[model samples]
Target: MSRQIIKDFVYYFSKPLPFNLLRKLTGENFIFPFYHLVADNTPIHIKNLYPAISVEHFKNDLEFLLKNYHPATINDVLAFVENGKKSEKPLFFLSFDDGMRECYDVIFPILKQKGLQSAFFINPAFVDNKTLFYKHKISLIIEALKVTKENFLVSELMVFLDIFSANNKQIIETISRFKYSDTSKIDKIGKILKIDFESYLKKEKPYLTLSQVLEMQDNGFIIGSHSNDHPKFREISEFEMQNQLGQSFNYLNKNIHPQILSFAFPFSDINVPFSFFQFLDTKIKIELSFGTSGIKKDVLPKHIHRVPMEDNLKNATRIIRSEYAYFLLKSIFRKNTINRQ
Candidate 1:
């Protein structure tokens, strides 16, 4: 119920990105720069609950993220795949999937200064123009539905599930079973509760503005597609997949930049097929495709693995030095074979 537990809960729940069984498997540990990376901005919803993050620390983390972690480009991934030659630098890709406004103020400058490279996988639906998305639309509905005098209300979270009245257990179970790199359930629940994704961005104080993208690109960072309309790859159909992936391409290329070299499978996980990536990788210049699982190699000439950092902890530094992190990764290094497979 307290903040500490919530923090512990986030750390415990969010694993594999930072720690895993791989240490037991290979005895070689890889530093995951993407795993449990701290975001620059404070989400309006969670700001009140946690302590203020030092903007200085955030900046420093960004610097470390770029220098200590991150791949040179998609070519790095391709190299790992083809040559199996381990790039001396640990394979870390600095990625901010949602394209938050903070990327402009907090992250971009640091990247630009270091002459470092990272990818920005954005949802074009929420670009400069505000558009209604299912998640935001639902939030709008539920927000209005509630009768509250305080600025924010803490409902049983379960109550929110009851709104759809469509088998909360099944839906929650469906959702709980899902594990991916981004905030899938949050966006999905937002859509479910009639929160308009784009409009909600407008309503919220902070979001990635289109100008941010132009600036980041001008600074030498790569831009990529998140999705047109964010959809769970496991739940959606092939036509849906095409449309979803296509929308990411259509909007990003049309509105942001057509030459986007990458595509991040929204909530990519165990259920989704590798074939979903086939078309995008083969035809389009999408040389990079990001997902959570199944990546165990070094930076190659193609795509690479990223550790999905979340907001479950109060102390950001703990992510790199937590017991779980030490055990999971230390075990990896002990093994003779670096499973940069």
Candidate 2:
């Protein structure tokens, strides 16, 4: 069976354990849970990418975390890392990626009401709706293709994508596989589909604006860089990676002026080298850096891995339980902690 299927099977059978007990069994006192966005209605730019956690589900997650774990702040994380600070209960640090507008419009009020603090990671290039991420462009293109009944248009799109014999599913798979370096092709796909991403950006205002980010910062929420334009770091060269971090951190310092210099890898931190962390330490002097390698430890003391809460469309309860269960399973084979080259 596939690894995911085995994990699903384990999670299915592991659901009987109480959530608190499951957490204790994992022997991890700190957890970082992260999300892209939460909404009552799924947005077109994110619909095809992954399931957006509903507002109600997000609230339930907060309630569960608050009950079982202390909500940790950026300062708390720093103290824990620097001084081995301990709490009576385990700490859970919540964060959101992509700087989506729902963060301000929908999520902020709920967090405020609950009296919780979290981090927000943003791409400098996409802030203020100035540009759309290339992945979002693919989503818009796919959405457009769904409504298009004209066979000639489909034929043209297939020809342009060089998948002239592809079906709807294959076309979407091809478009979804378009890399960050394939932005030009994505733009061409948008043109062929008559989908104006700029128009969508103006109308939807999909990303959090500069003012919103600043306000969130003022209200005790941590703001961090998520690279300049959200590229997969492994695919880019070391020079490009440095440039991305430098430009984004420069933007953050100039615009947001956040007290903490933090970052979360755009896609992931897999295959990232140990030298990169050393560069971050000596050059960038980043306070914290995160990756989406769920429920694992990292060799670098300052680089932490976060649990992606949106997987399998599961809520925080199931997701957290499954993560803990998976961590234990990996431990048996000594594969739980991530080691950088």
Candidate 3:
């Protein structure tokens, strides 16, 4: 079975165990739960990518975390990591990626009502709806294909993707697999499908604007860089990786001027080298860096592994319990902590 399938099976079985019991067994008192966005209606840019949690589900997630884990601020997390600060209850730090408009429109208000703080990581390229992420462009093209009935266009798309015999589903699967390196192909697909991503950006205002980011910062929410543009760090060279971080950090310092320097890897931190963390510590002076490696410890003291709360649209209860269960399972094989090379 695939690793995900095994995780799902474990999650299914683990859900019946009480969360507190699972938590105690895992001996974990700190968690960083993160999401891309939250909305009642799925936006076209994100619909094909992953299911954005509904406002109601997000509220439930908050309620559960607040009940079981103390909501922690960025400073709290820093203290815990640096000084081994302990709380009576375990701590949970909330954060959102992608700087989606829903963060300003829907999410922040809800967080405010409950007196919670979170970090919002954004790509400098996509800020103020100036451009769309390439992945989001792929999503828009896929959505277009679903609604387009043009036979000639479909045939052209299949030819472009080099799968002339592909069915509609096959074509979408191909498009969905397009990586950051496939930007040219994604652009061509958008052209062929007549899906203008710029128009969508202008019309939808999908990402948070500079003004919105400023307001969010003023409201006690921390802001950080995801990158200059969201790219899979594993695919890029060391130089390109450093450039990405440098450019985004420059932008954040010049424009946002956040109190603390922080980052979350755009896609993940898998295969990232130990040297990179050293660079971040010495050159960037980043206060914190995060990865979506779920319920694990990292060898680098400053790097944190955050739980992705949106797995298969599961709630906090199931996801957290499953993470703990999976952590224990991995522990038996001595694979729980992340050791960078």
Candidate 4:
């Protein structure tokens, strides 16, 4: 059976029964769920790649969590780390990534209404509309391809990617594999597809401005660095990685006053060198960092793993239950550690 088939089987067959029993037996307590964006009307083409949800669904998610789990803040997690206080109820920390503009216009209002706190991790280069992430450029290009009957050399594009098929899912996956350092090629492809990111940035203003970030900070929300630009750590050299972290911290320090200096890895934190964190220690005091690898405990305690809520939105309860169940199973087999580097 395929992985998805197995995962679906686990999600459907065992959830809320065997899942609950496993959780109770294992004594797992906290979950951190993170998202990329929230929108009431997201384009269908980019939905899978970027993963956004409507305001109504987001509210439903929060209400579900509120009923089943205690919503915790970054401060609460830090306190747990420093003083080791465990919660009596299941705890959750909500986080958003990529610093999209919908965060300010759509998500913040809902969060305010619910009296909840969340952490927003941003790419400094995209904050002031200075530049856009290459992955987003891919999203726009794919959207353009859906509409226009343009005849372009998709095979030429495929040369840079590991993919062989030209299906939409594979296309997005291939686009996702584009190197951050060499975004010029994607930009060239965008130009050929008549999808201009500069125009999009000016017209739509899809990212949060510096003022919006400050307002979020003023309202007691947390802001953390994603990077200067969103790059995969494993693909870049140590010097480039340090520069990305340093420049991002410098930008956030100069603009926003976050109580804790925190960060969430862009793309992922897998295969990252141990020396990277040690280097960050010398430059800045990062209170916490996060990665998306479900409920696994990090060897570095400050580095927390957050579950991605984008997928399995239709069956939130079942999905979360299965994650806990899977955690218990992995713990038994000694396969729970997601990051050894």
Candidate 5:
């Protein structure tokens, strides 16, 4: 059977019976769930690449979570790590990543209406539309090329990017490789295709602005740093990792004055060095950090794992139930997989 079918089966079956029984028998634990963007519909320019949650579906997920779990903030998790204090009820913290502007528009209103709190983890470079992520640029260029069918020398692009591919899929694969370190080159390629990223930033305003972030903070939303630039943590050097941590936190400290310093890894923390957490704990005073690895435990208690809730097939409660069911099954096999460091 396909994994989705299995997960769906687990989701449905556990939702009605096994989940309730398991929770009553074993008790409930904390869950951290996250999303990237929540928009009414995916924008034409980036629809091919990223998935966005419709506002209606987002409301549904929130409503589901509110019904089954106690909503939490980063501050609450921070206190839990510091003093071993946890809520008596089943708790879940909601967070959004990459500092997308939609969080300000669609997400904030919904959160406010529900009287719940969430953390917005933003890249320092993206605030105020200073620069665009290369992944977004790739989509914009692809969209422009699809419209104009701009015929540039594919060979030249391959040579410039040092990639060995001749197909459209290869071209996208090559572009994805230039994520953090060499985005300027990607921007140059986009410019060659007559797709101006800066102009898009000026006009589209795809990212959160400083003032918008400040207003959200004032309205009881938590602002946490994702990074200075969103890069896969495993791909960067220790020095670069430290710099990302320092610069991002410093920017938030200077502007937001958040009570506690919190950060979420740009991508999954699969290959991140163990030393990085040491720096965060000892030198940086990081209260909380997050990863999107879905119902797992981290080496550091303060480093929380959040399930990605952007998948449309699963609602928040369904995702939680799946996690519990999967974890329970694994536990029966003498596998403590969820707490893998």
Candidate 6:
């Protein structure tokens, strides 16, 4: 009757707890039937918002997936294609972005155990084997510049910082209120911000090496592109977007031809227009894509929506229809006339 049911269901999805086993353990399948779970924080806190899992728990899930689930390669999945037929189950795709080395160290093992395939979206820019310190620095800089507690193109924080240092942050903070859309202003900003982008890339962790990414491919994980420098696509111009998208796909294809067929918008948001996406859809049969919204019928064509594993742990409500509930509760909190209507 309420949203908590879904939130609880989401939390449950992330856990290794077998829903059947939990039901057997306790006659009750869910404890929160009315509560709705809202995944906390903006997308800026994507990974950190989720609760942390121990290596052991991560391993258990892998063991379960391997023993129970069905996985396939791109070729194998496309086999579901007839001259033109969609599968019964919507494609079950698992993808990770940013190439967090932890994904390499942490997620790969679980994926391997199940032989459950997924996509690993990596920025060609951050393929070095270290932290993208620039991302963190730019975030602090942006915070200083921002007049409001606005949403961020989160993934770029460290990547941007690689080139723009405190010296640059100081300038951005000073002039941020000016209209960044003006050509002259943008030129000034670009000139001031310019650096040897390639040189700075060497400081961070290089995404899965050609070998590590290829191993995922061999193991059946689809390796995909997340754009060069990983800037938010929505904020940039059509020209900039093309360069970012073109270079990412071009480079990955050159290194490993792991299905250049899929693309994910960088720092996804509802603001990315349907027409903008129509641009991508018309060009490639990008079988799947990822973004910030929860998966729903209306949002189709935007296709893939992702939630982190941590939200499942912190809020039992995430699994039990919490998303629907979160909207309702938020609406009520807003003191709108719709409540009376």
How far does residue 205 in candidate 5 sit from its true spot (Å)?
0.3
Q: Which candidate is the best by lDDT?
A: 3
lDDT of each: 0.52, 0.87, 0.88, 0.77, 0.76, 0.47
Q: What is the alpha-carbon lDDT of model 2 when measured against the actual structure?
A: 0.87
Q: Against the true structure, what is each candidate's TM-score?
A: 0.63, 0.96, 0.96, 0.89, 0.88, 0.56
Model 5 misplaced stretches (Cα beyond 4 Å):
1-18, 22-28, 44-46, 73-75, 83-87, 153-165, 333-341
Model 4: runs farther than 4 Å from truth?
1-5, 16-22, 43-45, 83-86, 152-176, 338-341
Better of 2 and 6 by lDDT: 2
lDDT of 3 by residue, 1-341 (tens): 77677677788777778888888888788999999999999999999999989999999999999999888888898887786433446899999998899999999999989889999999999999998899999889888888898989999888787897778899999888889889988988888888888788999999999999999999999999898888899998878889999999989999999989999999899888788888888999999999998988877878888999988789998788878888888889999878887
Q: How close is candidate 6 to the true structure, as a TM-score?
A: 0.56
Clashing residue pairs in candidate 5, if any? none
TM-score of 2: 0.96
Ordered by lDDT, highest first, the candidates read 3, 2, 4, 5, 1, 6
Tens digits of per-residue lDDT, candidate 4, 1-341, equal 76445556666656547544655655667778888777767843345374567777877878878877788877788876665434556788888888988889988888878778989999999997888777777778777655665435455555545446665457656666667876987888776566778888888787899999999988889999998998989999999999999999999988886789999999788888988987766577788888887777777767788888887455456557767766766677887775555
Could you give candidate 1's per-residue lDDT for residues 1-341 as a string of tens digits? 76335435544544545333423233323333442123445553334323335466656555544443454664555564465535555554467665656667666776667665777777777566455334333334344334333322223344544434443334434344433323555565555454456554556734477777887787777788877756677777766777777767776767667344677666553355556555666756576666653223433245444444544543334544342343344345652222322
Q: Write the per-residue lDDT of candidate 5 for residues 203-315, one digit (tens) a residue.
A: 98988999999999999888988989888888889899999989998898898898668889988887777788889889888888888877654547677778888665466
Instruction: Give stretches of model 1 more than 4 Å off.
Output: 1-32, 35-41, 45-54, 63-78, 132-147, 150-200, 203-205, 258-260, 294-303, 314-317, 320-341
RMSD of each: 7.9, 1.5, 1.4, 3.1, 2.9, 10.8
C-alpha lDDT (0 to 100) for residue 238 of candidate 6: 66
Worst 10 residues of 5 by lDDT: 332-341
